[model samples]
Target: MGYSKDAEHVGALGAGQIAKACNNYLHWVHSASNVEALALAKRYGVDAEKMREVLLKSPGDNGTPRNFDRYRFTWHENDIDLVLDLAQDGDLILPMAALTDQLVKPITQGEVVRLLGEESCVYLGQTVAAREAGLDD
Candidate 1:
């Protein structure tokens, strides 16, 4: 942990906060990736729960990477805002993160399941309807 005033660690006051923001940003990326993948799976008739199980045992982080158990250590409500604030201050543009942020907003706001949203369901249904209507080959 970087402290404000100390000879031990050479850093300023916002150092710890910056570290936290970066970590949270990475968490957001991973969480959004998992949610998007699951949503796509459900769209194609694969059982969501079964796919979650498969992801958990895939590899890395002892299954934490694919953990669907919500509200434990997932992104809090203000986390993304904080990260975006930091990015703005640093003049950084995170386009992918920004895009994923919109994709997972409903889940974070508790409008749907923690990692799955009704929006995905609606989108998937629309795709199916279009296909049935011979919109695509």
Candidate 2:
């Protein structure tokens, strides 16, 4: 716990939590971005799978190549909720997290794969419902 360590020496408590929440927010946003791109590819009759494979190879932060496996749904929904709640309690406004929290509310384990697409590490129920409804592909 970076925050815990910081608190011990620097009196930092919320900083680490805020940083973590923001990072989680990015993950949700990227997950949605990937899923939406796949859905659009499917609509255009493009090879969605191939596109995902290529995109994952594309550069990310610091020009590092994206790894598809990193996006796979693996986190339990409860974990996401816990972070969102923490962010809220700390007066942090993680819009993406708030939105993602709502999105994951009804998702089930079985639907995580299809909704997140390739290499989804964390399952978000909202992604599942959106995919199942033919809205997210």
Candidate 3:
């Protein structure tokens, strides 16, 4: 259960921060994609729980889906911003990171909890679709 073997010194200075930013960027992107997949399932009446179970056993599995309920939304925005800032400093173009930043900016802690909660099958996309369809909550 330990990842100590994965730890190593990459470079002289500031490399750790860059590595951390890259890790956070992947984490945020994966988390967002997990939610989107769940939302897609709900939309298609595919049984969210079953979809999640299958996803856990499939190649699509990641830490996000396995630990969905335990995820915290506090630092996602800041983390993505750090990534974008790093990309800007390097004069690199990262459209996906920019899109991820925008998509994650509007999410609230309560929304994530409610959407991904153990006893709940409702997702943000489901709610949005309902609203657009003129249905009542």
Candidate 4:
């Protein structure tokens, strides 16, 4: 399938879905240490350092793409798009309904870093949402 340059054609993925994807990815990313998560990302062909930059400095880290808000992580369209594209292609995301699964375990970025013993940065907007959803435990 061809990619859409016009946000109008692909349109917005909606806040709920975006939130779900972000939260799911963040949860997985932060669920384990840097070694484990990066290994997972590496298996999917993502550069660990690059993934950190994209997640920490991309628009996804700050807020939704539709909103022209400056985020803690200043975003470049090309970089952000590439990272999301890679992440999407990697199949590194959780199913959208993961939020409703009571049997699932809760994991946060804090624990990941603690386990890894290294500083890592991942999208925190999802962290915020997970907290709101009571999933950031």
Candidate 5:
């Protein structure tokens, strides 16, 4: 009844915290990407829920799309901050982590549900229009 098979020592002390931060970073990235993909599908006149169902069966499947509704969306900022800080300390550049940090704020603010809802196509359309207009710059 233990984690004998699932556990492995990664490194010396403090490594576990780093590993946890890395895992959290990926979780945030994946969850954001899942919402964005579904929103894209909804924009293209595809049923996002149906697309999600298909994606759940595909090689791109991750538990995010399935468990998205139940996600707490809390503490992500702190976790990503830790990851970014660690990267900075190591003199590394992680653009995806930076982007995830930005995306997580809106997701935590309940934007994910809005982005996946029925009216999301309009929102996505406007977003695309804005980007094309160079408003995103």
Candidate 6:
């Protein structure tokens, strides 16, 4: 076995959705190495540089202030505050529901796709639950 193809599955599990919805607020995550956006990516396991590129180029408010963009949040603060910032305050819906459910317990793979959206499922055509959502394309 070469171990070259070894890959760890992140299973979106609501975390990916959190990364998606909070793109706008990414500038404020406040990690030492990664400005803020990258920190959020690390929180949920995403390529910071890739995330910044995809999200920055996508739609939504560029300067919009969301949870991830807080100027006052300290290092000790929790992620729920950040999620809530983008979700409830920023009007970011998908990540909110996922984050909320995630708080009670870890989100399932199905829940990840449910919030992230099927279009995002570039790998396996989305989660099994996503199939129920129906794929017209």
For residues 1-137, could you state the per-residue lDDT of candidate 6 as single tens digits? 44347644346676655554444234332122123334334335454345555655666325422222233333222454565655666675765345343332332233333223332222123222222222343
Q: Write the per-residue lDDT of candidate 3 for residues 1-137, one digit (tens) a residue.
A: 54556866778798977887888898888877877787666555555557778999999987667766576677997899899888998999999999888776655556555554433443443472212222232
Q: What TM-score would each prediction reach against the true structure? A: 0.59, 0.50, 0.76, 0.23, 0.76, 0.20
Ranked by TM-score from best down, the candidates are: 3, 5, 1, 2, 4, 6
In model 6, which runs have C-alpha deviations exceeding 4 angstroms?
A: 1-34, 60-137
Q: What are the clashing pairs of model 4?
A: none
Q: Native-vs-model 2 lDDT? A: 0.51
Count clashing residue pairs per candidate. 0, 15, 0, 0, 0, 0
- Per-residue lDDT, model 3, residue 126, is 43
TM-score of predicted model 3?
0.76
For every candidate structure, what is the RMSD over all alpha carbons to the true structure, in angstroms?
7.0, 7.4, 5.0, 15.1, 5.9, 17.1
Give the 10-residue window scoring lowest on summed lDDT in candidate 2. 121-130
Instruction: Tell me the deviation in Å of residue 111 in model 5.
Output: 3.9
| Candidate number that wins on lDDT, 1 or 5 | 5
- Candidate 1 off by > 4 Å: 1-13, 59-67, 72-77, 108-137
Model 6: clashing residue pairs?
none
Q: Give one digit per residue, the lDDT tens place, for model 5 in 11-121.
A: 999887787788788889998788778766665666676788899999879777886766878888898999899999999999999998887676643455555554553
Task: lDDT for model 3, please.
Answer: 0.71
Write down the lDDT that model 1 would get: 0.55
User: What is the per-residue lDDT of model 2 for residues 56-93, given as tens digits with 9 covering 90 to 100?
Assistant: 66662321114433433556365577777887777977
| Alpha-carbon lDDT of model 6 | 0.38
- Give the candidates in order of lDDT, highest first: 5, 3, 1, 2, 6, 4
Per-model lDDT: 0.55, 0.51, 0.71, 0.37, 0.73, 0.38
